[model samples]
Every structure is written in structure tokens, then in C-alpha cells.
Target: MPESAHVTEEKTLSESNPFPDSIPERLRAQWNFLIEVDKLKTVLRQSPLAAVERRENDAEHSWHLALMVPVLAEYADEPIDIGRTIQLVVVHDLIEIYAGDTPLYDAEAGRDQEARERAAADRLFPLLPDDQATHFRELWDEFEQRRTPEARFAKAMDRLQPFLLNWMARGGTWQAPGVTADDVRRRKSVIGDASGALWEAASELIAEGERRGWMRPGQG
Candidate 1:
């Protein structure tokens, strides 16, 4: 072959198969990093806090709260940045993909949960480019602090969720766990600051559940 023809062929091959480091990010399978999150829902935590029949997996819990933002927005005491709150809920439980769900009462298990979750985030985020990862990490941290209006709403949604499940299902999960009326009341109390009306509703529902024997009586 002529020299010009040979060089042209070499250039074509280089374009087709660049070194891994030189490959365009658009060609990378980066967005697929969260695929592992699907497996998280099946990894059930050993907590009687919820029962199998009404047991919500981590993914369902995350997705439910993520989509529930609009329907439950009226409960918010003030206007919320709904878009940001939605994003926070979507990403909030992704770390459960690695760390598993820690229970509300299990302080011992929660001790290193932050570290484990951060490490998981590190592994998962790098699957995306640096900028995307940084944006997500910042949002996740803000959600944790509950400092922003959106974060406050996000936390409120989180609390409201299990309350709905436990109540709607007639304390379905808690029925077997022997979750007391006192426990239910205590859990719903913190939600008051974010939305007093919703807390009132949840509180009334808890009382009914106790009356119906789905939950224990409040301590005297």
C-alpha cells in the first residue's frame, strides 16, 4: 500500500479504539452505577420494627417518599422547594445499597453507618464523572443536616411514610413487633415541627390503632 493509505488506516484504527483513559465519557457506562441499588431493597434488616406482610423494602420506601412529595406537600408548615426535596429523597437511601437499613432504635448499629454509607457513596459516585458526584454528595449532606427548607420537608416525608404504612396497614408491621402506642406517639412527635397538622393526623391514627389493639396502650 502507498504510505498515505497506510497512515490513513492507522488513524482509523486509533479513532475506533483509543486508550481507556482517552475514551470519551459519553461512551462510558457511568449512569448505570446505581444499578446496584436495586439489590438493596431485598437485603432486609433484622428488625421487628416492621413485619413481612407490610414490610417495605428500601427501594420501595425511597421511591414512595420521592413520589409522595406533591401529594403530602400540604402538610408542610411553609412553602417548600419541592424539586430539591424530591431529589433528596431519591438519593437519600441509595447508600442502603451497601450499609443496609438501620433501625430508629438501634444506636449501636448506627454508630458507623455514616462511615459505611460514605464509603459506599465514594464507590458509587465515582461511577459518574467528578462534577456529577460532587453535586450529589453535597445534596446528600444538605439532606442529612435538615437545615434547608427542602431538607426539612424531606425529613418530614420520611417520617410520614412509615406512619402511613404502619397505620394504613393497621400497624401491620408493628402489630407483631409489639410496637406500643407510646412508641408510635414518640415517633410522630418530631414531625410536629415540620408540619403540625400532619402530626395531629398521625397522632390520632396512632390512638385509633392502639384502641383497636393493633398497637399497645400508652404508658400510664
Candidate 2:
């Protein structure tokens, strides 16, 4: 090789030097985020459906709800932005990486859980570029309010999910963890305005569970 050509190649390589060890180098962020999300698998709960076995993790729940959005789209109460609704469902539970699932009955505990979730979102998503992190945080916040139609539909699915588990899992996980009638009622009430039909369907399912003795009497 020519002497001038060798110097040029060495200089180019030095200019491409990587980010420091203390920081998340761009390439490492994606895998690190996945690792954090995978930790959710350890945070399982006794299911309401198959009280016999625990429910799936936050990651599974998020994907499952996202898939259900297309089929359930027609039933939403408000005219929804289906794309936005889908996006919200996809990222909603990322906060659980920091704040574990807070069940309905734990009022005091549930209160501060949202704060922790927001912090987790910031840490996990900023691993992406600035635009991506901001957009994701906003989607998560929108779901939190349940104000818009898209958010409402997303919220309802989140609420309905547990019932499906309990209904099919033979009991929904209610008895094993001892979710009471009052708890079931309060949680189901939130689902009403989001999708009147899905809410009614959930109500019917709960009633049937009660009838068959799958659920405790007076629950829902």
C-alpha cells in the first residue's frame, strides 16, 4: 500500500471512535430495553380465569391487547383514531418495568404507581432518539387520562383483559388472590363509556361466572 493511503485509512478509523462505557452506546439500547421488559415475566399474578395458574406478564398483555384492537374497533363509544389507539396499547405497560402491576383494590399503593411508571418510561424510551422518546411518553400519558376516544378504547381493553383470563381460566384468578365483589364492580365501571358493547359483554361474562360458581356470589 502507498504511504499516503495507509495514513488516510488510520485517520478515518480513529474518527469513528465509540461512546463511553458509562453511557448507553446507541447499539446497546435496544437489547437493554428488551432485557428490562423481560424482567416483567417474573412479576406474574394468580389469574382470574385459570386461578389454577398465574396470568402472563406485562409484555404479553400489551401485545395481546394491541391485537384485539382491530377486531374491537367498531365497538368503541367515541370515534377513535385506531392507529393512535393501537400505538397507546403497545407502549402502555412499559412503566411496569419500574412499577409492578398494581391491582384494583390497592388504592393507596396504586396512587403512586403512576409516578414510578412515568419515570420508567423516561429511562427506557429515551434510549431511542429524542423524537421517539417524546412520542412514546405522550402515548402512555394519553392512555392514562382515558379522555380521548383512542385512549378510552385502549383503556377498556386493558380493563377487559383480566376478565377474559378469569372467565376462561375457570375462575379468572379472583378467588386465589381473593378479589372481592366491590373490587370487581369498581373496576368494571371504568369500562362502561369506553366501549358500551365490550363493557356489556364483560358484565355478562362476570354474571355467568357468578352463576356457575366460577366467581364468588355478589362479585361484579
TM-score per model over all chains: 0.77, 0.76
Clash count, candidate 1: 1
Candidate 2 stretches with Cα past 4 Å from truth are 1-35, 48-54, 176-178
CA lDDT, candidate 2, residue 208: 72
Off by over 4 Å in 1: 1-23, 26-29, 45-54, 105-108, 176-178
What is candidate 2's lDDT per residue for 165-201, written digit by digit as tens?
Answer: 7677766555645566556766777788787888888
Please give the distance, in angstroms, between residue 144's alpha carbon in candidate 1 and its true position after superposition.
Answer: 1.2
Assess candidate 2 and give its lDDT: 0.68
| Candidate 1 residue lDDT tens string, 1-220 | 1111121121222234443755566445342454444465664533223445545667678788888898888779989988888999988877665556776545576687778777766666555577777888888888888887788888888877877776666655456455578876776676776788888887788878888988778784
Question: Each candidate's lDDT (Cα)?
Answer: 0.68, 0.68
Question: Could you tell me the lDDT of residue 6 within candidate 2?
Answer: 21
